[model samples]
Target: MAVTRTLEADVLRRQDPELADILLGELDRQSTTLQLNAAENFTSPAVLAALGSALANKYAEGYPGARYHGGCEIVDVAERLAVERAKALFGAEHANVQAHSGSSAVLAAYAALLRPGDTVLALGLPYGGHLTHGSPANFSGRWFDFVPYGVDAETGLIDYEQMRLLARTHRPKAIVCGSIAYPRHIDYAAFREAADEVGAYLIADAAHPIGLVAGKAAPNPVPYADVVCATTHKVLRGPRGGMVLCGAELAGQVDRAVFPFTQGGAQMHTIAAKAVAFGEAAAPEFGGYVRQVVANARVLAAALAAEGLAVTTGGTDTHLLTADPAPLGVDGRTARARLAAAGMVLDCCALPHADARGLRLGTAAVTTQGMGEEEMPRIASLMAGVLRDQVEGKQVREKVRELVTAFPPYPG
Candidate 1:
């Protein structure tokens, strides 16, 4: 949405034009470039309005009807709306919308369940695991003994048998099922079975696809996981925040883990924004949008493979895909720079079983911008040409500007 089409910019511009200019500059940047980032999307005007509401001034530090701060009766309503909407949207028995980010949500899940030095099982970092899963530099690894599982080297798919074997061997306290770049529908049932066999708690770090789940485009993990952690943005198109969902049995544990433990005061503005997004997702149009998101990703992946980019897993079933750019005479990092220069933006990710990095891009943003299956091939061709140096940067950039302008994210 045109965020500045609201009131904050007017007052801020009058009081602090310096910071106001920065805001406008960032808006212009987003408007001009193709945001193919996997974990991003265009939030609706309603969500933006909630984010800039007076709730931003509040400091509610606990659950509804039990906040420690005074004057929280109003913001409590917002939090309750968020909690109820989230539970109804995902069919969870309980929901916690107070976690600050996806990482924060994961930390709280750990605090609620496993103890320090407990063994945990999760996807390996090189094979699409999130840092919170077990990165040595992060608290997850330092606090627990993380046993890593990996995907198949040839198929670029999760090795479920290996996961089961690892779970049985390690007998971990908890098992995490999610990824930053798998580009496929996760087998939550399989993960659940493995966890059950091991008597381990299953935590679904579903930050990427929870939006899809909300729209019924992806499988709901609520039934299969002991805890589900997700971000409110991305395909959900909500504010930048995190939420945790679980059964009634674990609700108190999850709630306490979020408040007075992993985090302090909840951002009422963000929670309000999340409620707006949840309401939007429940609408029928959002279902169509998510379906198109996957359709666009499929076409884009196929087109990239046709352009010799070696699309990971041969293609994708989600909004994102990873592809090796070595065939285009450049590495993923170099390709990213070249594409960024040409007004196409994305991230570089580790290719499964490969020493070289690969490009990871998504259709969530572009799909929200209204480009569909027809535009996917053109995007792939443009990216391939840029990496291969077959097109001038200026020409590619001008074309990108034209495409984005034609499908302006917000129509004034």
Candidate 2:
């Protein structure tokens, strides 16, 4: 559907022109640049409309039909649609659509399954794990005993045998299988086997690949994992929210953990938006879009490799690809800024088992904008020029604007 922002603009402009100007500037930025951020996407206008709807006024403090508030009848509809759609999309026995963010979902899931001080096994942050997994600064690391597993130094792949050994040695209460920057398919079965051997609750943090799992482009973790956590944004291209899915046996625990435990009330507007995005993902076309995302990622990785950048794991089987720009004599942070200055947006990320960071690029946002394999080489060339200091930033920015104009992120 075409995006019509006239009403949004008028209302915001009348109420607060200063904030309205910032919003419009962000829209312009998104429209003109190549958004290569791994965890960001262009949510549909329908999703945006739902987020800005009257549903936001409601304060539904409990599950549907069992709310603490009196006037939750309409908000219940939105929450129910979101819950049911999520369950159907992921084939989960139960779904909780109320966690505030991916970190919230992870916290709630951990709370439901493990106790404070209980040992939890996960990938190390430096090896592509999320902060919630084990970083000392995060609540998960502070509250629980977070033991880390890492990718092999040479292969840049998760060492399953090492993980299995750690699982048996530490015998953690929970084992997490997922990543923030790793660029290959996860062996969920292997994780499941390890978790089973250790009698640990297997939690699959599918925040990065939920859409790919939904589109059957990646492995579904539901069957192998005891609980799955994800953000509605990212590859799902929905509102900025989080969800948890699990079997019926753990439904009550998970639900209670989310409400009256981790959080008090659900954001009904965002839940409504999640319903719309879930519907969109369920449609037949989403699968094609997801496949193209992977195709474009592979091409982009190869193109970047051709530019003398080291693509981690050699290439990608999903929407994201990580590369160390160190070979080009540029640090990840500098490369990110240089690319942004040239109208390409990505992030600096730590490579597997390395102290030095690298660039993490993803094709989800560009794929949402209808870019395909044909556009990958051009994007890679532009990014290389910026990072390698081969082409002037202004010239690359102009080329980026030209390409973005042809694509028109949000058609009206």
Candidate 3:
């Protein structure tokens, strides 16, 4: 349990009736539901304990040995552990565990590599790119001159020729690779070559695939890119925080950017939790878990595709797959809401440069609950029934609830 448990109101107000009620409500929800969002996962209970520990009380203002404040001995140890574990997990020359989120990590990387108003080449927002990549409304776009790229019209894959053309034409200072929606494996070697041709830095945002990369199931870009940024919460199964890993040449700049430019005092408790998570990822069983994540995603995608739904990108090679529910005359929002009511959860996400009819589904959360191929068929069947609005959906939801109860996610 966390050392900060005493700080919770429950410990102080044992006589209050509302405390147990709220806890039981949340517990009941997790005890009888499924979570399928691609960018979301269920952290281990121990990870949660670490995240809520007493380390949160610390006021460490800088990196391990160089802090602005005094009494940072424990915080220094935690932060150093987080950095060391992150470096080992990703095979990076250096790691910074201070960024509050993936967006902050991206900002820090850009700040380290490029001046304000410098040009950057990245995928367009409508084409699976994140807001931080260069959305006009975001600081990245507002601060820099962003040249966006898109996938081919016919094939749902990025246009390398177009990217090369953009890099040549724009002379960008950096090229950002990775996406929230694109499904195939990225050609980091091609990106590395393109960046080199333009004398631009290569920044890989592997927030969606860090778990796969850590398990060595997905292609790693640490050796090929100047910097890589990712969230520790998503596939890494840690706290809701971010990390920046880079080559030794850029290490000091990355650290300063993450520390003084993007955030204030770091969350030392989360850093310690991130250390624990990285330790878990380094274990041999983590590779097996990541492989199962991919296998379960493939089975889910194929099952949905067999039912006439449009599985995006032909198929997925990672932990996520996108499916269009429009064939059954339903939109993504409606499908997601109905699925939630049925005790299954998925997020509605617009397809890359397509209409808002597709749903982004992942297996990480459910797979963490010890589910396997057995849940895929039922999940696909329930999705089909929900989209079709058949009476069978009610029956399917009952069975789904039963299965979820059997495998109780996030058990306390």
State the C-alpha lDDT per candidate.
0.93, 0.92, 0.85
Give each model a TM-score. 0.98, 0.98, 0.94
The segments of candidate 1 whose C-alpha lies over 4 angstroms from its true place after superposition are 1-9
Q: What's the best-to-worst order under TM-score?
A: 1, 2, 3
Model 3 stretches with alpha carbons more than 4 Å out = 1-20, 392-396
Better of 1 and 2 by lDDT: 1
| Residue-level lDDT for 276 in candidate 3 | 90
At residue 273, what lDDT does model 2 achieve?
96
lDDT of 3 at 365: 83
Top-down lDDT ranking: 1, 2, 3
Q: Write the per-residue lDDT of candidate 1 for residues 45-151, one digit (tens) a residue.
A: 88988998999999988888998899999998888998999999999999999988999999999999989999999999998999999999999999999999999
Q: After superposition, how far is residue 189 of candidate 3 from its true place, in Å?
A: 0.6
